[model samples]
Target chain A: MNPAFENITSLRAKLAARDITPTEVIEALRARCTQVEPSVSAFNHLDWDTALREAATADASLPLGGVPIAIKDVIAVKGQPCTCSSKILKGHTAVYDAGVIERLRSLGAVPVGRCNMDEFAMGSSTENSADGPTRNPWDTSRIPGGSSGGSAACVAAHEAIASLGSDTGGSIRQPAALCGCVGLKPTYGRVSRYGLVAFASSLDQIGPFTKTVRDAATLLGAISGRDPRDCTSLDQPVPDYTASLEQGVKGLRIGVPKEYFIEGMDKDVEQTTRQALDQLAKLGAELVDISLPHTNYALSSYYIIAPAEASANLARFDGVRYGARVPDGKDVLDVYSRTRALGFGNEVKRRIILGTYVLSSGYYDAYYLRAQKVRTLIRKDFEEAWKKCDIIATPTTPTPAFKLGEKTGDPIQMYLSDVFTIAVNMAGLCGLSLPCGFVQRDSTDLPLGLQFIGKAFDEATLLRASHAYEQSTEWHTRRPVL
Target chain B: MNVEYVAKLARIDLSAQEIETYQNQLGSVLEHMDAIASLNLDGIEPTAHASPVFNVLRKDEIKPSLPVEDALSNAPKKANDLILMPKIVE
Candidate 1:
């Protein structure tokens, strides 16, 4: 049987029934990756030998037994090449597994490869990747949304059964939306970030990109819970996320924020999102009109706080430590300057400089400090909305995937791609983006996603609502002809 | 915007042309950031951490760490088990 496009639940059942061995699944996936990697450019490090070897001995009793999940290069898997798709980390191999990797292993999930991403998870398009862009499987000329582009693409193209991705301001969800898959960014602190190469520490959370909402829930259940290594990891019990997958969203209040449907939103996105909401309403959900008043400030505030934190987090990548280094320097300072200049891409350098300037002595109050305060206001906006609604709904992106180089030259236009999704991260709420409809352009069907934001630790409700919508609609089943 | 000074602080070297380009780009970014000032945030506290859990303390017991081989494995320049760096204060 072709393992491609099958969800983990079905794969596990097949493994248990002895219809498919773990080695057969790994071999089939490896063959699929070989077929698609040239066009999709999905992986940086594909360890087929180790994956097949591990699959041979995998225990079927474990939850994710023998299932191969592609990992975002930003998240470390021990002994694998963890490049984050940057020249700086050219030959760097992770010495230890990320907290999520450890959890995946305990559940018997085999990591098949390190998927490409935006350099240091910085940019909306995978065009920022030093390893080259991951093309959208739906249309090879268009980009797979990023920084988790490879993670989303591999899942959409069926190179891997599921994939893990990091979302710092819509990295996972945006890519999933563009690639036509299910992506969930858990509540901040819901997943441990101990081994994730730090991008913007507070906003970055690791999540899964999967074929179905049930697979997303299953993967989230396995990879979540507290880890002592990550200080921000919530000290709470991990729920069985799949337990409520069948519970339809009856008596659920889904907020339709007027601010999200703004003047410049794409007509197709608006129409499709409205249609999805109507479908949800038909599924017994009450669509309440609500307003997240501080929504406009999210993008601006995110640009400030994320860069300020990134500047601090990225300071460790000097010439002295791990990864690539420049030897042509007279002094230590020269080495640092030369190495960083040669190492980082233009976008990363721009962000680092912007971050430094904002956190500088004179501009602290005007930019960084004030931006943090605006962050508070944004959170409060969501807090107020929760009183009247159980879930918040919006278009996952303002539009579907654009051409490869469409927004490359304009930073602001690229930043606007995440306008609908960034507020959830700033408010530290859990969000899920699932395919709802396809917008046909030039005879090519590009997928549009519907996003749902839920209260802290209320991912179960998100799963139930999205699962209901997913089951009711046929959008998730429409695979891109790769 | 003093792009050179910020680049110096970031320890990244930039050409004169790049500096001029950054000045214009970052100036606009700062202009975008100016939107935050319009909010009447008098007594609002900044959110440093999204989760309430903080100042977590763990047991003082020693735990096994990555071995010397693994620790120095990724170093660009290394001698046996130690990472090598350029001369300083000489």
Candidate 2:
């Protein structure tokens, strides 16, 4: 068996036992990347030379020793291109390592591939990537989900042992769900955002995409903690996540929000989610009915606030300082106008326009301010639910992965893909998505994710419950046939 | 949806066709934003951040800066020790 196919825990054990050197493991990973590239196209830029050089001397005692991590392109890695899968940053090499990258290196992980993503993390489907879309491993005809599509696909297809992804309105968890892997979004401020390119500053967070729940915990522990570079990073001491993995979910109150079971959700997805809930109840978890009345308004509020922030964040790429530039004339205004128009993709342009409209003078109070007010209500909804339950459970997404061109023409349908997952980001809380069940669709079995939302800086409970649930289920064991 | 004006403010030039298409597209998004407009927001405080960490002031001290070579590595246009841009004044 290729060492690359092993999860981090198993691989680490083998490396420690002197059964395989890091070179052999990385070589196997490179082979897998070559084998899977034709079908998955998971990476925007892959550097095996740097990976091998780093891995050759990795300290085996470190937590992630000799592991190859596929990083979402939005995160900076010094001397490597950080394109964010857009033409705007075509030749822009990162000037320094992001906080996560520094942590990953300190723990002996080799940051190998630049995973593809929706341009500037704007779209739910990775079809927005200028390089091309990353197809789902379960069914190539379908999308892997995004804008962390490449991050999830790399882990799913075994191109990398694990990956790092940023979640801003479901970018990490949603794609991890669609790809049948474990993805965790730490509580806002639980992880530093200094190196992550801003999508929506208030909502964006860095997290992990791993093959196993334990690997998720390990990776999260390695990359998380306070970084002085990011002021929003929580100063709380990092918990030993691996210590609580075996803690059972008995006597735990699992809240099932009625709002997540919307009318348009797929029938099979609904059935599988309910069955998983039943299994949890059978495992001694007390299922409680809960109401988050402001759930429906979350999407409306998110679209406004995220775009408004994105507009301000993305304005730094005006053909000056760095990034791709189009010299139109001697006039600086002409340069800014033409460069941005030529550099950005359609979706990005549309969002900039939307953001500008909301923040404009006449519409500021009506749209931006109103959305912020609605955001307060949405956070309160989660706060109210917390009073009754230890953890809130929901289907990670409304349905399994859809066909490549399924909802591309209509942006609203695309936006609806993140309905269930966006609110967690709005409230700046942590959430986890792990495989709980599988639904056979179009002659292929697609994975369904179960999400557990936890309180602020309360990843311990989320990891505990998800670990228990994962141990009881065989869904994570099923791998897609290439 | 005045896409032309919005694009101008965003520093992007849009074609006539793009303007027309964005008008319809952004119009629908605006319609969705209108949903929040109808809600009663009388006593609610706007939540720009969900965390309780406020006014995070740090010591005003100098830190290690990026090397000059690293800082200018990705510049599209560079002269000796400085970034070059199009002429701004006549």
Tens-place lDDT digits, model 2, residues A62-152: 8777887889999999878899999999988898899999999998888988999999999987999989999999999999999899999
How many Å off is the CA of A161 in candidate 2?
Answer: 0.7
What TM-score, computed on C-alpha atoms, does each candidate reach?
A: 0.99, 0.99
Show the colliding residue pairs in model 2: none
Stretches off by above 4 angstroms in model 2 are none
| Cα lDDT, model 2, residue B11 | 96
TM-score of chain A of each: 0.99, 0.99
Per-model DockQ: 0.85, 0.84
lDDT of each: 0.91, 0.90
For candidate 1, write residues B12-42 as lDDT tens digits: 9998988988888888878887888888989
The fraction of reference interface contacts (C-alpha pairs within 8 A across chains A and B) present in each candidate is 0.84, 0.83
Worst lDDT 10-window in candidate 1 chain A: A1-10
